[model samples]
Target chain A: MKEQDDKQIIIHVDNLVKKFGDFEANKDLCFDVYKGEIFGFLGANGAGKTTAIKILSGLSSPTSGIVEVAGFDVYKNADDIKRNIGYMSQKFSLYEDLTVKENIRFYGGIYGMRAKLIKERTHELLSRLEMTDYADKLIAEIPLGWKQKLAFSVAVLHRPKIVFLDEPTGGVDPITRRQFWDLIYEAVEDGITVFVTTHYMDEAEYCHRVSIMVDGRIAALDTPDGLKQQYGAGSMNDVFLKLARA
Target chain B: MNRFFAFVKKEFLHIFRDYRTMIILFGMPIAQLLIFGFVISNEIRDAHIAILDHSKDEHTQKITEKLVSSGYFILSDELKNENEIDACFRAGNAKLALVFEPGFGRLLEKTGKANLQIIADASDPNSAEMLSNYTQAIISAYIKDLNMAGYGNKIIRAETRMQFNPGLKGVFMFVPGTMALILMLISAMMTSITIAREKETGTMEVLLISPLRPIQIILGKVAPYLLLSFINAIVILALGFFVFGLPIRGSLILLLAESMLFILMALSLGILISTVAKSQQVAMFISMFALLLPTMLLSGFIFPIENMPVILQYLSAIMPPRWFIVIIKNIMLKGTGFLFVWKETLILTLMAIAFVVVSVKKFKLRLE
Candidate 1:
C-alpha cells in the first residue's frame, strides 16, 4: 500500500543459496518483506519454498547468503531471530491432548511471557476468536478450521515481529481459508508481518506482494495486480502458468 | 528456568494423560519384579517324589521322613515296585524316584555298606540336578550322623556351603537385574518415543522456532522422565526388599546414587536415539531391539555373562546395564561400599558422559 522506500523492511534476503549434499534445494534467491504486510511465497511441491522458509525462520542454515529476519543475521543471531518470529506448519502444530487454554498457556510460557500477561492474553484471545466456549476443550475436539486458526493465533501469541506459515491452510475449505486470511489481515493490522507459503493461486491475490518460485529459483515477484499487469494475464494463476511455460 | 519448568510440566501432562504410558511407567516394574521373584525361579519347593523302600526298616523310613519334612520334597506316591517308578515319572506326577535295593539294616550294621539309587527325571536337567544334589546331601548327613554315633569307622564326606545367599534364592539375582532392566526401559524408550512424537506431529518445528534453545528443549523432554524413572527404581527396590527379602546389605545411598547414574546414562542414550529416529515407530523399534533385547540378553539379566560365547562376552562389556547389574549386585548382595564398586561406577559414569556428548553432537540445532 505504501511506497517500498518509505516502508520498513522486516525481512531481508540477498543471493540466498542452500544445497544438500550434491543437490541444490535453493539457488540465488532474493527477496524482502516489509513490516506489517502479507508476503506470499508461491511454488509447486519441491520448488524449495519450504526450504527457503526454513532458512529464513532460523530452522535451517543457508549454505551461503545474507538473510536477515527482524534485523538479526540468520547465521550468527539465529536465536535472536527465532525469538522475534513464530512458525506454523500444515501438520496442525497444536498438542492434541492439551486443552485450547493449556496450549495457549504453554506457548506463552515457553516464549518467556509473564504469568499474568499470559493469563490475560489467553482470556483476550479466546474471546476474540469466539473460542471462549471451547477454551477447556482439547484440541482434538475442535474442528479443522478452528485448529488452523488456533495454530495461527498461537504462532503470533508472543506478538512476534514476523510469523511464518508453511502452507497453513493446506486442506481447509475455501470458506475457512477466507476466514484464515481474515485473521492474517487482523494480525497485520496489529503490526505483525506475515510470511506465508502456499500453492493456492487464489490465495496469492490476497497477498500485498507475492513471489513465485520454480525449480529452486524465484522466477517472478511483485504485487499480485502488478504481476498480472506485467505478464498481461487476467489472474495470478495465468501469470504463474505463463512463467512456468517460459 | 520458568520456561523449562513449563515445558517439563507439559511433558508430565502427556505422560499422565496417556494410559498406555501410565501402565508402562508403573505397571511394568511391579509385574517384572513379581514374575522374576515368584515365577521363573531356580529354588525348588514341595517337589513330589515316589519312594520304593524294599527294606521297610527304621533307617529307610527315617530317611524318607527326613526328605519329606525338609520342606524340599513331598511324598507323592509309595511305589509298589521298580516298574512303577517309570510310570510315576511318565505321568509327570513325580520329579524324582528314590529306590532302596533289598537293604536290610543288618547289612549296614555288619558290613557298613548300603545300596540306594536316586533316579531323577532328568528331563528338566537343572531341576533334576538340583533334586539329586539335595537327596544326596540329606543321605550323606544321615551317614555322618551314624558315624558320629560310633556305628562304624569314619567314612569320607564332602560338604558344600552356599555363601552370600545361603538359601540360593533366585530373587537375589533378579532384583538387581530387574532394576537395571526397568530403569533402562522407562528412561531410554519412553524419552525417545516422546521426542519422536514431537517430530512426527510437527510440534518440534514450532518449538525449535521459539525462543527455547535446543538444549532447553532436550532437557525439558528428559526431566520428567528422569523423575518418573527414579520413582520406578525405588518401587522395584522396595518390592525386592519387602516382598522377596532381598537385602540392601551396603549403603542404600550409594546404591541409589549408582541407580541414578545408570538412569542418566539411559536418558542420554534415549536422546541420541531420538536424534537419529525420524518417527515414533522407528524410535520404538530402535528402543526395543537396540535397548530392550540387549539389556535382557547381553546384560546377564536372564543369562550369565560368563556363560556367553567369547564374542558375546566382549559385546556385553559395552552394555551399560551389564555394569549396572554388577554394581547393584556388589552393593545389594555383597554389601560392598563405594571403594569396592568404584571401577564399575567409573565405567557407568564414563558411559553416561560419552552418550551425552555424542547425543549433543548428533542433536541437530538446525533441521537439516
Candidate 2:
C-alpha cells in the first residue's frame, strides 16, 4: 500500500470500549480504514470482532469510544452514517421468498432510490452478475454461490461509500470463495471501501491490511507479507496460529 | 407514502402467499359463528319429562296435556308412585319429573290450593334450570287462562315483556360476542405472529438497519391486519343481519365507528405482544393464551359477566373485548346512540394509546 498520508481515513475508531454489564467485549480498540481499501477484520470466536463492527455499523453503542464512519460520529450522527454505508449480515441478507429482482428493488427502494434508477440498476446488476436468466426466480431456488454474489451486489446497489460484510463467505466452497473475492475486488476497484470480517485465513491474506483481534484487543495489525515476516511464518494461516496461540 | 405502501404490499403478499394461514385467518370466524349459532344453544327444545300423578283426576290430566303440547317437554314416561322418580332420572329417560298431590283436583276446588312438585335432574345444571323455568311458565299460563275463563279468581298478575329479543333466539345473544372474538383473533393473533415471523427469519434486522423508522416498521406490520379485521367485522355483521336476522338497533355509522375503535385497540395489543415474543411460536402461544382465551371467556361472550364472582367480574372489566361486547350489544340490539356508549369508546381509546406507547417504548429499548 502507499504511505498513510496519500490515503484518506474513511473509518476512524479510537480507544473503543464496549461493555455488557461488567464483561468488556471490546477493550481499547483502535483502527483506521483508508478509502478504497479492503480492510479485513480477523478473529476467533468471542474475540470482540463482531462487537467492534456492530459499533461501527451503528447497530450498537460503545461504552466509551470515539468512532467515526463515513465522516459521521457514532454517537450523535448514526442516521447520517447509516445513510452513507451498506451492511450485508452473515445470515443470507436477502429475502429467500422474494424473487432476485424484487429483492434488489426492495433494498434500493428502502434506501430512498427513485423508481427509474432502481429499475435501471436492477437491469445493470443482473446482467453484470450474468444472472439475467435467474432474475425472476425466488432466492430459495437459486444456487448458494449465485445467492452470495447477488447478496453482495444488492448490498452495494445503493452506492454507499463503504460496505460492511460480516462473514460473507462462510461455508462456501474454495472456488466460490475465490469468485466471491473477485466480486469484492471488483467492488474495491470502484473506489468503495470494503470492511469485512471472515474466519478464513486465506481470505485474510487477500485483504490489503488485516487486524487480528485476540481477547477483546488488537494483537496485531499489518499487511499479509509484513505479518508473515514478523512472525517468521510461511503463510497467513501460520501467522494467525502464532498470534492466536500467544 | 410510497415506502409505507411498498411495505404494506409486502405484508399483504406474505398473507396471500400462504394458503394455510389464509384459510385460518378467514375460515375461523365463520366456523366459530356457525358453531355458536347452531350447534351450541341455551334455549330448551323437547326436554324429556316423566309425570307422577297420584290423583286420578281431570285437573291433573289437563296440566300434563298443557306441558306436553308446549313443544318444550316430551312426555316420555308415566310414574305411578314417587319411587319411580329416581328410576326416570337414573335411566336418563327424563330430565324432569312432575308430581301431583294425592287429592289435587278436590283440594284446588275446595281450598284454592294444590301441591304440584317439580323434580329436575341437576347434573347438567344448565338444561335442568331451563327445564324448570319452562314448566313454571306453562303452569302460570294455565292458571291465568282458568281465571280469565271465570272458573277461578286471582288477586294479582305479573306480565313480563321481553323487549329487544322477545323470542330469546340464541343467534341474537352470540352475534356481538362472536364479532368481538373474530376481531380479537384476527387483529391481535395474526399481527403478533407476523411480526415474530419477521424477527425469527432475521428480516427484522434488515428492516431495522434500513432508512424506515421503527414506528413505520410497526405500523406497516399492523396496517394490513387492521384492514382485514375491519372486513371480518363487516362480514360478521352482515351475516348476523341477513342470515341470522340479528338486528342493529342503533345507528349503523356509530356501530361501525365503534368497531373500528375496537380493532385499533386489538391491533395495539398485538404490537405489545410481538415486542415481548422472540419467536413465532412464542407469539402464537402468547396470543392464544394471553389474548384469545381471556377474550372468549371474560368478555361476557358465552357467559354473562354480572353472574360471575366478584373477582371475575372485576377481571372482566379489564378485558378489552368485554367492553367492546357491551358496546356492540347496546348499539346493535338496543339501538343506543353514541351518547350511551361514549364511556366504553373512551376506555378503548385509552387502552389503544397505552398499548401503542408501551410498544414504542419496548421497540426503542430493543434497538438500544
Candidate 3:
C-alpha cells in the first residue's frame, strides 16, 4: 500500500453527526478519502450509508462536523463544494423522455458549459461509450445497464473533482456490474476521486479502501484484504457477516 | 441567464412530449368554454305554457295571440278551466299557466282594473322566475299599447332595463368565469405537478447538489407554464369575442394585464404547494381540491356571492379568483377602467407577493 503522507487527500471528515429529531442517523463519523481512489462506503439497508453520502455530496447539511470536500469547508462553502462535485442518486435521475444527446446537453448547460464544448463532449462521450447509434434514441428506449452506464458518464462529464455514486449498480446484472466498475476505473484514471456507497459485499473487494457502517456508525474501515485478515475471514462476505453479527 | 433559459427549454420539451399534458393544457379551455356556453344556459327559450281564456272576450283573445306570438311561449296546451291547469302542470306539458278574468275587456273599461293570474311551476325555480318575468314584460307592453289607443287614461308602470347585458345572455356570465377557472388550473396545477415530478423521479436530488440556486430552479420550472397560460388566456378571450359575441368594453390592455397578474399569483401558489408536496400525485390532489374547487365555487363564477351564507361569503373574500373574476367582469362587461378595479388588482398583487414570500421561506435549501 502507498504511504498516506505521499497521497493527496480529497475529502476530510471529523466527528460528523446527523440527526433527524430524536433519531441519530450518523454518529461521530471520521474518515479521509484520497484523490483518484475508489473509496467504498458499505452497509446493509438503513445503516445510514445514504445519509453520509448525502452529507458529503453537499445535498444535506451535517449537524456538526469539520467536513471538508475538495479542500472547501462543507458548512461555509457548500456552493463551492457543489461546483466541484458530481452526484448520481440511487434512483435513475435522467429524463427518460429526452434523447441521450439532449440529456447530455441539458446537464452541460446547467453546469454552465459553453455550447461548443457541450457539442464536442457529446460526440466524444457517445463514441467512448460505443453508443453512437443510440445517441438519438430516448433514454426510456435504452436497456437498464446502458442507462446506468450513460448516467455515470453524464455525472463525470464536467470532470468534477469528486463523483459521488449512491448504489449506482443496484439491480444490475453481474456482467454489467463488472463493466460498470471498468467505467469507474477509467474515471479514476482521469484523476477524479470516486466515493461510492453500495450494499454488495463482493463489490467491496474492488475498492482501494472500504468503510463498513453498522447501526449509524462506522464499525471497521481498511483495505478489503486487511479487513479480511484482521477478522480472520476468508472473503469480504464473511468479514461483513462477522462485523455485522458482532 | 443562459442556464435559466436552458432549464426553461427543457421544461417546454417535457410539456410538449407528454401527450396527456398537452391535451389538458390546450384542450381543456375550449372544451370547458363550449360546454359552459352551449350546455349550461340560463336564458329560457321555447317554454311550454297553458292558456285559460275564461272570459273569451276580444281583449283576452288578443292578449293570448300576443303571448303566443312573443316566441317565448310555445302554447303547448289550451286549458278549458281552472282544474285543467293542475293537470297541464302535473303532466309536464307546460311550465306556465295564463288565466284571464271573466269579462276582461268590460271589467277593464268599467273599473279601470282587471286581474290576470300567471301561475308558473316553481320546482325549477330559475326557469320559472324567467318565464314569469317574460310574461310580465309582454303584458305591460300590451297595456302601454292599449293606453296609447285611448283605452285607459292613468296606469302606473315600472320600466326595468337590464344593464351590461341587455339580453341577459348566459354566455356573458360564463366567459369571465371560465377564463378565471382555466387560468388557475393551467398556471397553478401544471407548475406544481411539474416541480413535484422532479422530486418524485429523483432528479431533484441531482439539481439540489448542483450549482444552480433554489430560486433559479423555481423560476425555470414556472417560466414555461407562465407563457403557456398567458396564451391560453388570450385564446379564451378570443373565443369569447368571436364565437360567443361577449364584449370587451374596457381597455383590452388593462384586461390582459390583470390576467397576467392573476397568472403570476397562481404560479406562485403552485410553487408554494410544490414546496410541501413530495410527489406529483399529492401536488395534483392539493391543487384540485384547494385551487380548482374554490375557483369554481367561491369566486362568484357560477353562483352569486350575495346569495351564499355569511360564513361562505367571508370565506370567498380570501379566495384569489374571486377578486380576479370581479376585475374581469368590471373590465369586460361593465367597460370599467383601471380606476374601477384597482382594489382587486391590489389584492391580487398582495396575494402574489405573499405566496412568493411564503414559498421562498419554506423552500428547503438543502434536502432534509
| Alpha-carbon lDDT, every model | 0.92, 0.88, 0.92
Give the higher-lDDT candidate: 1 or 2.
1
Give each model a TM-score: 0.98, 0.94, 0.97
Q: List the residue pairs that clash in candidate 2.
A: B249-B335, B250-B335
Quote the lDDT for A76 in model 1.
Answer: 85
lDDT of 2 at A241: 92
**How do the residues B73-179 of candidate 1 rate in per-residue lDDT, one tens digit apiece?**
99999998999999999999999999987865667777888788999999999999999999998888888888988897644666778899998899998889889
TM-score of 3: 0.97
Instruction: Please tell me the TM-score of chain B in candidate 3 relative to the true structure's chain B.
Output: 0.95
Candidate 2: tens digits of C-alpha lDDT, residues B1-368: 66677677778877876787788778988888888888786777788999999996988999999999988889999998888999889999999999999999888777777789999999999888878877887887877887888867742344556688877788888888888988887899899999998888777877777667888899999998888888889889998999889998899999999999999999999999999999989998998998788887888898889889999999998999998998999999999989898999999999999999999999888876
* Tens-digit per-residue lDDT, A138-232, candidate 1: 99999999999999999999999999999999999999999999999999999999999999999999999999999999999999999999999
lDDT of 3 by residue, A13-82 (tens): 9999999899999999999999889999999999999999999998888889889999999889998998
True-structure lDDT of candidate 3: 0.92
Candidate 3, residue A180: how far the Cα is off, in Å = 1.2
Residue-level lDDT of model 3, residues B47-91, one tens digit each, is 899999878888788888888898888998878999999999999
Please list the residue runs of candidate 3 whose C-alpha ends up more than 4 Å from where it truly belongs after superposition. Answer: B365-368
Residue runs of model 1 more than 4 Å from their true location after superposition:
B153-155
Superposition TM-score, candidate 1 onto the true structure: 0.98
Ranking by DockQ: 1, 3, 2
